[model samples]
Target: MAAAARLFRDAADPDSVKMADIAQAAGAGKGTVFRHFSDRTGLLKALVVEETRQLREQVLHGPPPLGPGAPAEERLPALLSALLDLKLNQRALMLALERAGAGSPYLNPTYDLWHSEVAGMLSGVHGDAAADYLAHALLAAVRGDLVEHLTGQGADPDELHEGLRRLCGSVLAHRADGTV
Candidate 1:
């Protein structure tokens, strides 16, 4: 996995990095790599899962603002910020995973988990009626493709983070103003 991560990180086009290359880099046989991962898509997913395990742990069990105890207003922004940071830092790996014939990201189990978390927090601020769709919209703002495009176009990471912060603030403020 570390070998694959390095190759993907250095890859100009991650899809172009073949399974054989990964096997060679890992000092393992192609058959061994295939046996362990099933396919390139599986390998990409495994890398993402490994990379995000720490964040998942924080969201599941850490202290306030990211974990369970914070108010929705705080937790929502923290969660989105964390996700945005992850996407920014893991841009290559994420792009690879998203384009890995894994189907619509909305249908992904990871997406569902994030959506559920976002919607749950949004419900506390905006009521259950709007939470589901609002969560989807908010998540869309951080889509891997969109992030990649923006960064490719020279959008700074700090600028993206600030934009997301404003977006979250606006959404929460709308609730305070009784607009949604």
Candidate 2:
């Protein structure tokens, strides 16, 4: 698994990754890789699931700013930032998984987790309806492809983070007239 991870991370093109490559990199037979992972998509999904578990742990039990100790205002942006980091790191694997599934990303359980969390936070600051819509919109803004596109066009990390901060603020803010 470690060898497969290294190969995936170092690959110039994720679409070119194959079970044979993973098997050779792991110093094992092709049958061994197949027996463990079934296929390329399965192997890539395993990698993503492993990475997601750590993020879940941080949100579920890790310290403040990201966990439970911070206010909603602080936590919402923090959560988005953490998610952006994850998407940034796993862009290749995620892209492979999406291609293999060839379905709506909304159907993915990870999207549900993020949507639920963001909606909950937004609900506290705004209303239920706006929260629901804004949560999905905000998640869209930080999508892997969008981030990749922005960076490829020369936007820096700080610029992206700042954009996220402003986005969260606008979504969470109430109108000056005391209305949504």
Candidate 3:
């Protein structure tokens, strides 16, 4: 699975990833590939689900500075940093998934899992409302738009961290009345 994932990641042309290529990368026969994944779409779906599961695990229970025990204020930035790293590192596979349209919808269980983890983290320090707000904020940040904008500007991960930190802090510290 990891070998297949690497092939997907390394494929220069997203449309060119082939079952025989994945089989070669996985050191398995074509029959073995069929036995395991059934088809290319099946393999892609498995990869997406596996990656989503791994990401959720990392965000929820993996080592900190980034995991659940960290303060929401701290964890939010770490989460964004991890997300940005994922975006940069896995750009090709992500693009393939988007093109294939074969995985879970954006609002599917993967997102619910993320929303719960982020909202839970935020709720720790800011209460339910603030947690919800931060959850949405983090979600918005993780989606491609903000990350793409930052990347287009040549902003490094550290720069993203600092900017997100300030944004979350400002939002969390103020009321609807515009008073600090």
Candidate 4:
């Protein structure tokens, strides 16, 4: 899988990454690759699924801000930043997953988990109703296409991170603090 991932990462076009390429890179036969993965889609999905699991584990178990211990105010921005980095870093493989018929990202366990966590956290800062909408909005902000589009148009990631920081600060602020 390492060879396949490397080839996918380096390929000019994902469609060009054949089993033979992966097999050669892995010092195995094409049959060996197919035996393990079934086909291209299987291999790609495995890569993407592994990434999702790792992200989920980190947020659920890793220390502070990203994990369980920090206040919602601190965790929310850290969560968004971490998700943004994941989307950006995994852009190519993620796009491939969509093309491989993984279907809507919204329906995936990863999305559901993130959405639930975000909404749960937001409920502490905002009320339940506002938190639901705000959580969806926050997740939307870090989506792959928008991130790609913004960065393609010269938006630096640091700028994006700061924008998220300011947005979260505003949303998570108390009602009497002029949040509305």
Candidate 5:
């Protein structure tokens, strides 16, 4: 997985980095790689899961503003910021994952987990009425393709982060005032 990640990170076009390339880099047999990952899509999914493992652990078990203990207002922005950073730093791998024909990201267990976490936090601010839809909307703002497009257009990372922070703040403040 580390070998695959390095290749993905280094490749100009992650989709062009084939299974054989990964196997060769890892000094493993092509058959072994294929047997383990099944295909490119599966391999890409595995890589994404591996890459996101640390963030998932931190969100689930670490300290405030990311884990369980912080107020929703704080945690929500922290989570979105972390996600945006992930999308920015892992742009190549993310774009490759989306292009891998793995089907809708909405169908992925990881997406469901993130959505549930966000919606649960949102519920604390807005009740259950708009939490689910709002969670989806907030997440859509950090979608990989959108991030890539924005960055490709020379959007500053700091501006993106600030925009996300503002978006979260607006959502929470509006809900608090019963204006959402």
Candidate 6:
């Protein structure tokens, strides 16, 4: 079953993942694959949900410089860098799941939970609105095209970090009172 799961994940790509290909990769007969998954959609759904959960956990609680408690400038860069890595490493899995017509798993776990967690964190750095905006912008920035552009160019992570700092700093630098 684990092997089948891995095969299903690995078989997915930007375009599609055929059941036969997944079965071949798993070294399982098609009937066995169907027996376990019932259908391709089932496998894809499980894979995407599991993957999204893992990714969200990493972003929320994984480690310093990657998860919470880091300064916004630091957190922002780490978030973007980690996302880029995910895109590169899990390119096929992410793309395949995205093409499957599912909404973001991140949003589904309760938008208010994420919004408050992220927004609360941002409020510490900026105000509530700026934090909200920044969080939204960061999410947008990490999508397919941006990740492709950054990682495809072989851009250094530190450079990316500094660049984000400069950008955020320009817009978000503040007085001690924390107003813009």
Q: Top lDDT: which candidate number?
A: 5
Clashes of each: 0, 0, 0, 0, 0, 0
For candidate 4, the TM-score is 0.78
Q: Any runs in candidate 3 off by more than 4 Å, and if so which?
A: 27-35, 38-41, 49-55, 62-64, 102-109, 123-137, 144-153, 175-180
Candidates in order: C-alpha RMSD to true structure: 2.0, 2.6, 3.8, 3.2, 1.8, 4.6
Please, what are the lDDT tens digits per residue for candidate 5 over residues 137-172? 999999889998898899999999999999998888
User: Evaluated with TM-score, which candidate comes out highest?
Assistant: 5
| Residue pairs in clash, model 1 | none
**All candidates: TM-score:** 0.90, 0.84, 0.69, 0.78, 0.92, 0.62
> Which consecutive 10 residues in model 1 have the weakest lDDT in total?
101-110
Kindly list the per-residue Cα lDDT of model 1 for residues 72-141, writing each as its tens digit: 7789889999999888878788888888775456766677888999999888777887999999999988
Rate residue 46 of model 2 by lDDT.
Answer: 72
C-alpha positional error of residue 57 in candidate 1 after TM-score superposition, expressed in Å? 0.4
Please list the C-alpha lDDT of all candidates, in the order they appear: 0.86, 0.77, 0.69, 0.80, 0.86, 0.60
Q: List the residue pairs that clash in candidate 5.
A: none
TM-score-better candidate, 3 vs 5: 5
* Candidate 4 ranges with C-alpha deviation above 4 Å: 12-24, 27-42, 52-54, 98-102, 174-180
In candidate 4, the residue pairs with backbone N, CA or C atoms under 3 Å apart (3 or more residues apart, or in different chains) clash, namely none
For candidate 6, lDDT tens digit of each residue in 1-180? 455446544653445457776788778889988888787656655665565566578667877675777776566556556665665566666555444554452444433344555565568667776778766675555455565568669976566556655665654466337566
Ranking, lDDT, top scorer first: 5, 1, 4, 2, 3, 6
Better of 1 and 4 by TM-score: 1
What lDDT score is found at residue 80 in candidate 4? Answer: 95
The segments of candidate 5 whose C-alpha lies over 4 angstroms from its true place after superposition are none
Candidate 2: 10-residue stretch with minimal lDDT: 96-105
User: Better model by TM-score, 4 or 5?
Assistant: 5
Better of 3 and 6 by TM-score: 3
